[model samples]
Structure formats: structure tokens, C-alpha cells
Target: MFCYQCEQTAKGEGCKTMGVCGKKPEVAALQDLLIYALQGLALVAVEGRKAGVTDEEANLFTCEAVFSTLTNVDFDPERFVALIKRTVALRDSLAQKVKAAGGKTDFSEAAFTFQPAADLNGLVKQGEEVDLKNASDDNADIQSLKHILLFGIKGVAAYADHAKILGQEDDQVYAFIQESLVNLLRKDMGLQDWVGLVLKCGETNLRAMELLDAGNTGTYGHPVPTEVPLGAKAGKAILVSGHDLKDLEMLLKQTEGKGINIYTHGEMLPAHGYPELKKYSHFYGHYGTAWQNQQKEFAEFPGAILMTTNCIQKPQQSYQGNIFTTGLVGWPAVAHVDDKGCPSLLDKVKSAVGLGCSSQGKDFSAVIKKAQELPGFAADTDKGKVMVGFARNTVMGVADKVIQAVKDKNIRHFFLVAGCDGAKPGRNYYTEFVEKVPSDCVVLTLACGKFRFFDQNLGDIGGIPRLLDVGQCNDAYSAIQIAVALSQAFECGVNDLPLSMVLSWYEQKAVAILLTLLHLGIKDIRLGPSLPAFVTPNVLNVLVENFDIKPISTPDEDLKTILG
Candidate 1:
């Protein structure tokens, strides 16, 4: 298993023995084979689209399957094996549609003709043959570009899947994904063309993110500023982690008035800002910081834990039974709440929180019951609160004041210090950088990386908070919009604005978001804790030459460079 799709591959190179994220060799092989199967499925889907046949179910499944393979999402080999079989079934189904439409169905690419093994052992063997390091490309630079595109597409699929759950659908995004999957096998493109396609992955990701923002803000109502407690309310409690809003809402609804308090964990911390989710009286406050610390955090938590989507670390034995996974996030022997036909765990109590029911069928009753059975917080604890929901809507609502403050020199500069978090070293740079951000400059943060300085008392300039908590990483669209709006107000390009992006990436979503930034022609951005292991030096050089992207250095040095 030679996989290096994330920032923390083994020793900053491909993971040969196993994944740095605790994935076993068998799971890794299955994931690789799953990708191989998805490629075939995508090839057939692309052909179907050319024949004017687009299956909505196929599009949604493709997105979900691609997203599940992302780092730390699903570590269940059984799940991957099932997904591989589904991919072949779907691929063959789509191929038949293409043939019926008088289109050519046969292809030379092995992915188009690949077959899955009958069992898990056989499947893992098949997967080992098509692992990422064994891609057909021998050119290091081209392979790097292909990896960038593939990983970026995974991120895009994540956002697309989220948006689809919220009743938002974009056919062109689906088309780009399917076509790009097949294009990975293309021999016609030059290295520069591959570079263009990689950037286009970023371009397509912008649309996927836009749809997610719309689905979130449009359904849940634009997030307004809300202060969420870091302390726990003594009672039955359910801690919801990961980034799925619908799961959080469903749990909130089912647990309502049952004496269960729903607390946000990790990326779900942003849920408090949304009006629809926050209105639940039982919806409580945040628990832990980010995904990497979950083993420690989940163990200490006094109630049931639900991981929704990605960044799920292996559950500590102390709290494994107390943890439940929903959506595509999975772990071996972990209780899952994904049965669509599963009965509603609680009686349907009326609530106004109708923010799209695309993901409503799952029964969170088991989680609620576990919460009821467990002894919740022994007593009330007050860790105070942090301000959130300063997304595009709220920030733009104060556009006049912010523009004036910038003009009046009260606001020195802007730093968008955001990205995913990991347990690796050097992450303290984000904490230190935010701490060292000059008082006059505002720091805008989104994603779990905001955990570094989220609770810091940075005060405010005039009425605006010095540190703005943009939504989750899913809301990168909001951050981009905020930058564009500020640039438009100042009548300059985004790069010309006083804003600088210093991001820390840990996974594919961050990769996709970075690609979006690059596609927009934004320059002079600093990215760290470390560059992706998959990005060869030549590929890095292209990024540096084309976009002035660079790695992060010391806080003082970076501050001096940006501020001076």
C-alpha cells in the first residue's frame, strides 16, 4: 500500500506498510480497489452522459463512493468491498444504457474492463494491483498532477455529496467528476494540459462548494452570530461530531424534550451558528477541539458520540460502544445509524427545523437511547463561550463598517488562517500565528483548524470581532465570497487586498479548497504545516511559479514579511 494522498503520509512519503491514519493494509487495498472500481463506473457514466443519459442515482453514488475513500472517512474494509461491487454493478448498468443509445461501449482502458474479486481477500489482492503508486503514468510530474486532480476530485465529491443531501444538485459538477475520472487515463494531453485539468478541478470545486453554501445558508437560514458555550450542561448528553448538518439536526429533533442535550464536536461546532439547528432547546454546546484529539476527547465525554462523515479516528476502547457512526463514516464493529428503513428512535415530535430531509431516514434513536442510559455531565461546567456564525452574510451585513475601519487604518490587515487539523507536529504554528497576529489585523478562520485559537479573546476593532469564525471547512465558499466582496469594496484584485491566506491542510477537502483558491488566481498564499507528500518538487515549482504559493515559516518571520 503505497498511498500518499494526504499531508501526513508515512515519513512524508508514500505509506508503504499502512496509513498514517490507522488504516490497515487490507483496508488500504480495498480503498484502492474501490477507487479502481469507481474509475470504471465513472468511465461508463461519462459514456452514458455523452449518449444523453444521466442517472441521478449514479451521480449521487459516485460522489458518495469517491468521498468515502477520502482519508479518515471510512476504515471499514467490508464497506469498501461492498462499494466496489456496487461500482461494478452501476458501471455495467450505465454501459448498457450507453449501448442502448447507439454509443460505443467498449474501451481499451483496463479500468473500463476491470472486474472485482468475489471475496474480501480476493478483492484486496485485486486492489494491490492498482494501488495509487502503481498508476500507469511514469512521468513524475504528470503523476503528481494526476494525484492533485484525483485528490481534489475527492474533496469536490465530498462537498457535492453534502450539497446533494441538502437538496442541491448540479449536473455539470457531476459531469466534470465523471469526465475527469476517465481523463486520468488520457494520453493525448501534454504536461501543461494535465496542469490545466488540475486547476480545472479547483474551478469545478468552486461550484460544488457554492452549491453547499446555498444548501446550508438557504435551508438553515444564513448563520447569524452566536456565542456557544465550551462547557457542558449537566444532563443526558449526545455529542455530534464530523460535518454533517442533517445528522446533527435529526439527532437534535429525536432527542428533543427527552432530556438529552446535543453538543457539537469538531466540524459540527459551526452548527450552532445556523438558526435552524440552534433553535433546538436541547441542542447544547461544543465538546472537543478537532478530529485528531477524539480518542482522548471521546473517552472523557460523558455521553454518546456520533461521528458523521470524515476525519474519524479509530475509537478508543473505553468509548467505542458509546460511539456511533452515520453516513459514509465507518469503523469495524462501531455501531452505525445508517439504516434508511430503520425506525425513528423517538416519537416524531413537531419541530420547525425542516432543513431538507434528504438524510432524514437514518434513526438516531440508538444514539439517543445510549445518551439516556449513560450518566451525563456530573455537574455543570462553564468554559465560557466562543462567537461563531460570522459567515459571509453576517460579515457582509457589516461591510460598510469594515470598509470604513480599513480605510481609517484601524484594521491593519487580514489573515485567513484556516484548514484541517492533525495530531502531527508543527500544528502549533497556527496557534502561535494567531496569537502573534498583530492586534490591528483581523484573523478570519474556518474549518477545524480554527480550534487552535477559537477560544482566544482577541477583542475587536470598533464593533467587529478581531477574530471571525467563518463556518466549517464546507463553508470555504463563504470565506472566498468574503474576500471577493472586500476586494470589490476596495476596488482591487483579491491578491491586492490586505488579506493573506495561511492555511494548514490535513486531508483532501483542504486539497480541493486549495485548488479552488489557486483556480481563482489568488496568489502569495502560505500553506503548511507541511506540503502534501504526493506533490513532487516539480509540481511544487509549477505552483510556486504560477501562483506564488509557498510553505509556512516561523510566526515572527511570516508576520514580519506580511506586516512589514
Candidate 2:
């Protein structure tokens, strides 16, 4: 098994035996094979589109299927097998439809004509046969670019899937996914072509994030400044993790007034800022820091836990039964709540794919039931409160004030400290960097990376808070919009503005966001805790030469360089 798609892959290279994320070799093989199956499906879907046949089901499934292959999302071999079969079934079915529509279907490419074995062992063998780690003959630079495109597509799929769940989608995004998948298989594409494709993936991710922002704001109302308690109220509780807002809202609806208080964990901490979600009286404060710290946090929580999307860890035996995964997240033998039944927010994900979206979602009654059975927060404990709800709308509402502060030099600079967080030691750089930001500067933060310093008392600049919580990684569009607006107000490019983006990346979604930044001609961005293993030195050199991207140095050094 060769996997190096995340920041924490083994020894700064591929994981040959197992994933550092606790993914087993078998599951890794299945995930690779799932991508292979999607290639076949995408190959046909591209042809189908040419024939004037656009299937919403096929489009949504492609997103879901591609999303499932992302790191730390699904770790169950059984789940991958089911997804692989589903993909192949959809592929063949689409091929027939294309044929009926007078599109050519006969192709000898292995991806087109390949058949899956009936058993798990046989499927793993098929996966090994198609594993590109050993099978590809492309130059290292081309392979690196393809990896970038593929990983970026996964991020696009994830954001697109979330948007669709909330009734927002664009067919153009689906078309890009199929076209990119087909292009990745092209042997004739050179480094320059692949580079353009990678940038295009970034542009596509921008749209996906835009759709997600629309879905989130349109349904939930633009986030208004709200203060969430860090304390735990005495009652049965459920800690919702991952980045899906609809999942948390559905659970909030189902668990309403059942003597329960809902809490957010990791990226879900930003949910408190959204007007529609925080309206529920039962919805309470945030519980944990970031995704990497889940095992400890989940263990201490007395009530049930629900993981909505990605950023899940192996379940500890103590909290395994209390933890449940819904939507695309999975772990072996851990109880999973499928997108079915009522009092659920996710069955709608399935219905949204084919059947029209309805109010019904994934059943959370079981999760609520588990909460009732456990001891929740033995007593009321006030851990203090933290401010959220500083997304684009809220920040822009005070944009005139912001512009004035910058003009008056009351705010000397703007720093965007955002992106995914990880368990590695170097991650502490983010915490220290935010702590050291001058009083005259403001830090715009988002995603789980903010957890490193979210609770810090950074004080305020004039009437403006020094720290702004922009929302999740899925809300990159909001962050981008903020930069764009600031750029426009200042009549200068984003890079020319006094704002610097210092980002921490851990997964494919981060890759997509980075590509989006590069695509926009944003330069001199500081990126760390570590660089991606998939990027070869030549590819890295190209990135550095073109984008002025730098691996992070000490926070003090970076701050001096940027502020000077």
C-alpha cells in the first residue's frame, strides 16, 4: 500500500505498510480501487454529457464517491467495496445509456472494460493491479501535477457534496470533475498542460466553495456575531464534530428539548456563529480543539458523539459505542448511522441525489438515545465563553470601520491564520504566531486551525476585534471574498494589500484551497506545518518560482519578513 496524500504520511514519504492516519493496508487498497472505478464512471459520464444526457444521480454520486476516497473520511473496507460496486454499476449503466444516445461506448482501456471480482480479496488484487504508485510511467513532475489535480478534485467533491445537501449545486462543477478525471488518464498531457489543469482544479474548487457558501448562508442566514459558552451545562449532551452544518442542524432539531444540550467540536465550532443553528436554545458551546485531538476529547465526553463528515479518528473503546458516523464517514465495526430514517438530517443527502430533497434527514434518534443513556457533564461547569459569528457578512458589515482603521494605521496589517490543523509538533507555530500578532494587527481565522489559538484574548483594534472567525475550511470562499473586497476597497491587488495569508494544511481540502489561492495570483503565502509528500522537488520548485509559496520558518521570522 502506497499512500502519501496527507501532511502526516510516514517518514516524509509514502506509507508503504499503513497510513499514519490509521488506515489499514486493505482499506487503502480499496480506496485506490474506488478511485479507479470512478475513473471508469467519469470516462463514460464525459461521453454521456457529449450525447446530451446529464444524470443528476450520476453527477452527485461521482462527488460522493470521490469524496469518500479523501483521507480520514472512510476507513471501512466494506464501505469502500460497496462504493466501488456502486461506482462500477453506475459506470456500466451510464455507458449503456450513452450507447442508446448514439455515443460511442466500446473502449479497450482497462478502466473502461475492467470487471470487479466478487470477493474482498479479489477486489484488493484488482486494486493492486491498478495502483498508480507502481503502475504509472509518467515523469515525476507530471505525476506530481496529476496528484495535485486529483487531490484538489477530492476537495471540490467534498465541498460540492455539502452544497448539494443544502440544495445548492451547479452542473458545470460536475462536468469539470468528469473532464478532469478523464484528463488525468491522458498520457499525452505534458507538464505545462498538467499545470494548467491543476490551476483549473483550483478555479473549480473556488466555485465549489462558493456554492457551499451560498448553501450555508442562504439556508442558515449570514452568520451574526454570537458568543458561545465554553462551559458544559449539566444534562444529556451530544458533541457534533466534522464540518457539515446541516448535520448539526438536523441533530439540533431532533434533540430539541429532550433534556439535552448540544455542543460543537473542531470545525463545527463555527456553527455557533450561524443564525439558523445557534437559535436552538438547546444548542450549547464547543467541546474540543481540532480534528487531530479528537481521541482525548471524545474519551472525556460523557454523552454520545456524532461525526458528520471527515476528520474522524479511530474510535477508542471507551467511547466507541457512544460515537456514531453519518454521511460519508466510516470506521470498521463502529456503529454507523446511515442516511435513512426520520428525525435525521442526512437521509436527505440520498434523497437530494435522486429523489427530490425533503425535510427528512439521517435518523439521529439513536444518537439522541445514546446521549440519554450516558452521564452528561455530571455538573454545570463554566469554562468561559468564546466569540464566533465573524464570517464575511458580519465582517463586511463593519468594513467601513475596518477600512478607516487601516487608513488611520490603527490596524497596521491583516493576517489570515487559517486552514486545517494537525497533531504534529510544528503545529504549535500557529498558536504562537497568533499570540504574537501586534495589537495594531487583526487575524482572520477559519477552519480547525483556529483551534490552536481560538480562545486566546487577542484584544481589539479600535472597536474591531483582533481575531475574526471566518467559518470552516468549506467557507474559503468567504475568506476569499473578504480579501477580494478589501483589495477592491484599497484599490490594490490582494498581494499589495497589507494582508498576508499564513496557512496550515493537513488534507486534500487544504490542497484545493491552496490551488485556489495560487490560481488567483496570490503570492508569498506562508504554508506549513509541513509540505505535502506528493509534491516532488521539481514540482515544488515550480510552485516556489511561480507563486512565491514558502515553507514556514519560525513564526517570529515570518512575521518580521511579512510586517517589514
Candidate 3:
């Protein structure tokens, strides 16, 4: 199997044996096949638009198919196998309807079909043979462009998938996903077609992101300034990871006042800032940092680990029985908490760890006492003073300040250091990069990536913290807002502003954001700890010439280069 849609791909190239993320060969092939089937389904939807397919049905199809392939989200082969067959059936039925209505169809000769479990191994062998046979494309550059577009859609699907789980689905976004996927599969397409899809992916993702922001903010109330604790209490605790706010919300509601202490883990760290979630009296602080640290972090914690979303490396057998997965996240042997939709992690919490009963009559004054000491300053409470909502809207509101700052040299350069976090040691570059940034410059960060330097006392500039945590990774929307606002204020393009995006990516969400930046023609983005293994040299050149994308170097050197 060949896969390279992430930073840690085998030896900085495609993973031929097994994924560094611990994805087995069969799973990798299924994911690729899943993506291929989704493209066919998209073609069906495009035709179904003329026939009678509802936008809601199309949206669900795109979101689920895309989210299923995101890094670490699903590993249950049985579920995926069933999903592929179902998607293929949907695609074929849509195609037949289109043909009957005399509408155009792009169903290629390479139409995907389902293989029963009994024939799964045979199909896998066929896929391997096809990979070997089609190893050489007629034009290498064309293949590279297709890779960029396909990977970008994979990223877009991830964000769209997350939004769907929250009951926020957009039909246009699904149409774009379908259209873009169909484009990648078209062997007759040219560079312009691929390039257009890339930019549209960015614009549509901006909309997809807005839907999620509304869903999250509307459901959880706007995230307020709140400090989260680092240490877990000496009791039965349930460590929750991944990026699903809704699932987290449900879990919090079910476990409330039941003596079980809910601790946020990994991507869920930002949940503490959401007012609705933070109000939970039993809700505790963050358990660990980022998805990559889970194995070691979950080992000693005295409770079950509920992974709500992706970036979960395969679990060790030590805690397999205690670990629980909900929603789309799955593993081989891990007990899945929810089969239909929302399952009772509440009951599981009680059964697995004794309902956190050790402190039955213990006083809770000490936990509250510890939290009062460290209140974090996120987006909510800083309104007017620091301009709380930097999401494209609020940034544009202060457009003049940014332009004036650049002109007066109060802020000579803008640094956007954002993306997902991982366990690799080279991640230190993010910390050093923030440290080495010039004093006259401002640092904008989002997502768990900011944890690298969020604690540093960078002081303030113009009453704004030099190191600004905009929001979560979805909050990269804020960083883009700041850039575009500055551009409009200066009456020049966003790239013309003195801004450099230094991004570190780990999962598909990062992939979507990077594509969005590329789509907007944002240039000179320095990405690392390494470039994606999936990108070929030809595709890299397209990005370099058009967008001037660069891989991260030493913090000091990159600082001089970006700020010069």
C-alpha cells in the first residue's frame, strides 16, 4: 500500500509498508478506496442535482466519507468496509438516475465497486497490482497537480466532517467537495482545472469553517477566558481527547454531579474556554498536550481514555479494555461506547473506574482554590481592549490599527505560527521561533500548536500580547482575517503585507487550512517539522513559484529570512 497524506509518512516519502500512524495496509487501501468511491458519489450528486437529490443527503454523504479518512479517526475495518459498499451503491444509483434523465455523467472506466469481506483480501491484492501497474503516469507534473487537489479535498472533507457531527452542514461545501473530487479523477483535466479547484477549496472551506464556528459558539456559548488545570486529582478520572465539542458536551452533561471528573485531553484543551462547558463544576483541567503524546500520557492516568476524534495512534493493549471510542473514531479492540449515535459513557465511567468514588465525602474546596490562581486570557473577555474576536470580522474592524502599525514600524512583521501538534522533538522550533521573533513583530497562533509557547511571557505591544492565541485550529480563520484586513488597509494584496505564515501540521485539519492559504494566494508559508510525503517535487515547484511555500529552517535563520 502507498500512502503519504501526513507529516510523519515513512522516511519523508510514501508509506509502503505501514503508516507511521500505525494504520495497517488494509486500512490504508480502504481509505484510498473510500476516497475514490466518494468522488464517484460526488459525480452522482452533481447529476442528482438535476434529478432530485436533496442537498442535505449530498452534504451528509460528503462529510461522512471525508471525515472517515482523516488521520486517526477510524480504524474499524468492518465499519469502513460496510461504508464503502454503501457509498458505491449510492453512487451507482445516482449515476443510473442521471443516465435515465439524459444528464451528462463522468463515471470513468475505473468505477469502484464493493467487495464482500470474503473477497476483501482478493480486492486488496488487486489494488496493490493496480498501484504497481499505474506507477507511471503519462505526465509526471499532471499527476503532481492531481495529488495536490486530492489531498486538499481530503483536508476539506475533515473539517466538513467535524461540522456535520455538530449538526451544522452546508450543501455548497459538499458540492465543492464533490466537484473537486471529481476533478482530481478526471485524467483529461489540465492545470487550470486543478488550480481553480485548489482556490475554491480555500474559499469554500472558509464557509465550512464559519458554519462550525457558529455551531460551536452557538451551542457552547462563545469561548471565554478561563485557565485550565494541569494536574489531575487523585480519583477516578476519564481523560477525553480529539476535536468533537458536541460529544464532549454530551459527556459533560451526562457525567455532571456524578462524582466522575472529566478532564480534557489533546485537541479538547480549548474546550475549557467555552462558557457552556467550563460552567460544569465537576469539569477538571487538561490532561495532556496534543495527540502524539497520548500513549505515554494515558498509560499512568488512573481512569479510562475516551478518544472523541482523530490523531489517536493505535492503542497499547495495557489500557485497551478501559479505552472507549465514540462517534467516528475507532480501533481494533477498543470498546466502542456509542453504536447508534450517543451512548452512555456515563454508565461506562461508573463501571470502568468505580464512578470516581474514592472522594465520596471529601471536600472540593482545594480544586477550586488551585484554579482561581491562573485564569487564561483567550478571545472572549478581551473585547474592545485587545479586540476579542479576531475572526475575519473583528480583525477587519481594526484594519486601520494593523496598517498604521506596519507604517509606523510599531509592528514591522507578522508571524502566523499555527497548526496541529505532535511528539517529534523538532517541534521545539515553534517555541524557539516565537522566542526569536523580533520585538517589533507580533505573533499570531491558533490550535493546540500554540501550547508550545502560549505560556511564555512575551509581554504586550500596543496593549496586545505579543504572542496572541487567536483560538483553536479552526480559529486559523482569525489569522487569515488579520492578514486580509491588513492587506485591504494597505490597499495591497495580502501577500504584499509584511506577513509570513509559519505552519506546523500533523493531521488533515492542518491539510485543509494549508490548502485554504494556498487557495487565497497567500505566499511564503514556512511549513514544518517536515513537508508532506505525498507532495512530489513537481507539485512543490508549483506551490513555490505561485505561493512561495517554504519548509521551516532553524528559528533564528527563518526569523532573519522572514523579517528581513
Candidate 4:
């Protein structure tokens, strides 16, 4: 098995033995087979669409299947096996429909018929044939472009799935996913075609993110500035991780008044800023840092834990039994909650931790016990407050102030130090980069990466906080909006503005966001901890020449270069 779709791929190359993310060879092979099947389904779907035979289910399934293959999302090989078989059936059914509609059904046999191996060995062989590198032409630049688009679609699917759960759907984005997958299968396509498709993937991801932004803000109101406690409370607690607000909301509703307090962890930290979620008195503060620290943090937490989405590391034996996964996230024995919100898991939490009973007549005791525990938020201290919820709306609300600050020279430059956070070396670059930003500059950040220096006192410039948390990685949309707005205000292009993007990528979501930035014609962006392994030297040269993309250097050196 070979895989290198993430930042932590083995030795910055393909993971041949097992995924550095703890995915075994069987699981890796199954994922490869699943992607191949999805491409097959896309081929049939694209042909059927030509004859006016469209399958929304096929399009949606393709998006979700790709998402499941992302790092840390799913580890159950059995699940992938089922998806592969189901996808093949779906593809065949679509092919029949295309023929019935009198569509031009002349396509490669591999696109029409994909028989997934019934055993692990057979699957591995099938996987080798369809490996990302092998599927492409021999040109390294073309192969890199194809991978950039494929990984971008995977990111789009994850964000689209989140919005879909809230009943938001865009037919065009789904159609684009199918269209792009089918194009990747074409051996006759040229370099220009691949480049155009990569940019289109970026443009489409922007729409996907817009759908998600609407779904989230519409469902849970716009996020507002709110303080989140970094400590835990006494009595039984349930630590929730990942980026699913809907799951967190349902859990909050179910456990409300049941004596079990809910605490946010990882990307779920942004949930505290939502007005509807914060209204729950039982809702407490955050428990730990980013996803990379979950093993140690989950083990130390005194209550149950729920991972609502990706970024879940393999659970340790210490907390495996108490950990539950929901949505697209899956593990071998960990409990899962479905879309309806699993209430049994709440009961399991109650039974496992004994949160159902307390001293002061069960009601007052929970609250009193929590109050007695170490205060998660020390109201008297400055460390308790860190500004967040500065998405497009909040930032645009103060556009005049920001513009005036720039004119007044109170704000010199804007640095977007954003993207995923990992435990790998050189990650400390982000912390140091944020720390070294001049006081006259504004730092805008998003995703779990903000946790690096979020608590630091960067101060404010002309009433605007120096460090602004811009929602999750998908909120790269928000960052783009802010940049466009600033550009309009300054009467110049985004690149001409006094702004720089210092990004750190760890997963496919970052892949999609990078494409979006490139699609918008933003240049001179710095990306690290290191370049993707799949990006060959020739491809890297193309990016440097065309888009001015650069790997990161030391913070001091990069700062001098950017500032100059």
C-alpha cells in the first residue's frame, strides 16, 4: 500500500508500510480501491449527465467516499470494503441508465467495470494499479496538478458534508466533483487542462465553503465574541472534539439538566462563540489544545469523550472505551452516533461516569460541585480572554475602523498565520511567527493552528485586536472575503495590499484552501512545515514560477523578507 495525501506522510514520502496516521495497510488499500470505484462512478455519472441522466446520490456518495479516505477520518477497513462494493453497484446502475437514455457510452472498461477484490491481497493488487501516481501520465507536473485537484475535492467533500447535515445542498458543487473526478481519469488531457481543472477545483471549493458558512451561521446564529474557559469542572464531564457544531449542539441538548457538563476540545473550541450553544448553563469551557494532543489530554480528562469528525488520532487503550465517534468518523470498537443524535451514548456516559447522582439533591449539587472545582475561567486574570469570532461579518462590521487604522499608520500589515496544527517538528514556527509580529500589525488566524499563540497578549491596534481568530479552516472563505474587502477599500489588488499568508497544512482540507487562494490569484504565500511529498521538483518549479508559492524559512528571515 502507498499513500501520501497528507503532510505527515512517512518520511515526507509515500507511506508504504502503514500510514503515519496509524492507518494499517489493509485500510490504506481499501481506501485506494474506494477512490478508484468512486472515479468509476464519476465516469458513469458524467456520461449519464450528458444524456440527461443524473444521479444526485452518486454525486453525493462520491464526495463522501473521498472524505472518508482523508487522514484520521475512518480506520475501519470493513467500512471501506462495503463502500467500494456499493459504489460499483451504483456505477453499473448508472451505466445502464446512460445506455437506456441513448448517451454516448464509449469509455474505458476500467471506468465502467471495477470489481473490488474480495480479499485483502486482491485489494492490494487492485490498489497498486490505481495508485494516485500510477493513474497519471508520466509527466511529473501533470501528475502533481491532478493530485492537487483530487485532494482539493476531498477537502470540499468534508466541508460540504458538514453543510449537508444542516440541509444545505448545492447541485453545482456536487456536479463539479463528479466532473473533476471524470476528467482526472482522462489520459489524453494536456497540461493546460490539468491546470485549469486545478483552478476550477479552487473556485468550486470557495462555493462549498460558502454553503457551509451559510449552513453554520443560519443554524447556530453568527459566532460572537465570547470567553471560553481552558480548565475543567468537578463532577462528570463529557469532552467533545472535532468541528461538528450540530453534534455538539445535540449532545448539549441531550445532556442538559442531566448533571453532565459539556466541554469543547480541539476545533470544537469555536462552538463557544455561538450564541445558541453558549446559552446552555451546563456548557463549560475547553479542555485541551489541538487534535495532535488528544491522546494525552483524553486520558487525563475525568469524563467521556466524543469525536464528532476528522482529526481524531487512534485512541489509546486508556480512553478508548470512553471515546465515541459520530458522523463520518469511525474506529474499530469505538461507539458511533448517527445523524438523529444517539441518545444511548448519553446514557452510556451517565452509566460509565456516574454523573446521574450527586450530593445536594442531584440538582444543586452538580452546579455547586462544578463551582467548587478549579474555575475554568479566572475572571480576574487577563489570560482568560482571547478574542475570536472575527469572521467576515464581524471583521467587515468594523471595516471603516480598519481602513482608518491603515490610513493612520496604526496598522502596518496583516498576517494570516492560519491552517491546521500538527505535532511534527517546525510547528513551533507558527508560535514564533505570531510572537514576532510587530505590534502595529494585525494577525488573523483560523483553524486549530490559532491555539499556538491564541492566549498571548498581542494587544490591539485602534480598537481592533491584533490577533483575530477567523473560525475553522473552511473559514478560509472568511479570510478571502476580508482580503477582498480590504483590497476594495484600498483600491488595489489583494497582492498589492499590506498582507501576507503564512500557512501550515496537515490534511486535505488545507489542500483545498490553498487551491482557493491560488484560484483567487493570490501570490507570494508561504507554506510549511514542508512541501507536500507528492509535489515533485518539476511541479514545485511550476508553482514557484506561476504563483510565487514558497516554502517557509525561519520566522525572522521570513518576516524580514515579507516586511521588506
Where model 4 places Cα greater than 4 Å from the true spot, the runs are 341-385
Global lDDT of model 2:
0.87
lDDT, candidate 2, 451-493, per-residue tens? 9999988889877999989889978788889889999999998
lDDT of 4: 0.81
Alpha-carbon shift of residue 172 in model 4 (angstroms): 1.5
Tens digit per residue, CA lDDT, model 4, 1-564: 778999988889889888889999888877877888888888888778789998776777777788999889999866676677777777777788899999866676585667877776787678777776567668777888888888889998998888777667798888888888877777788888888998898898999999998888999888887777675555567788889888777777767676677888888887888888889998877778899999998888767778888988899998786777766788988766544323332352333321112121111222224323422232222226455688888889999999999999999999999999998898999999999988899999999888888888887887788988888888898889999999999999999999999999999999999999999999999999999988879878878999999999999999999987
lDDT of 3 by residue, 350-431 (tens): 2331111211222222222322222222222211112122344444555667667768888888788889887655899999
Angstrom error at residue 185, model 1: 1.6
Sort by TM-score, best first: 2, 1, 4, 3
TM-score of each: 0.96, 0.97, 0.84, 0.91
Deviation in Å, model 4, residue 269 alpha carbon: 1.1
| RMSD values, in order shown | 4.2, 2.5, 7.8, 6.5
User: Given candidate 3, what's the lDDT at residue 38?
Assistant: 72
CA-lDDT, candidates in order: 0.87, 0.87, 0.69, 0.81
- Tens digits of per-residue lDDT, candidate 1, 1-564, equal 888888888888878897889999999888888888888888878888778888877787888888988999999887777777777777887788889997768887898898877778899889888888676587888888888899999999999989888888899999998888888877777889999998899999999999999889888899999999999998988898889888787777778779888899999988899999888988879998988999999999989999988988888899999999988888999998765653321111112111123443678878888988999998999998999999999999999999999999999899999999888899999999999998999999999999988999999999899999998997889999999999999999999999999999999999999999999999999999999988889999999999999999999999999999
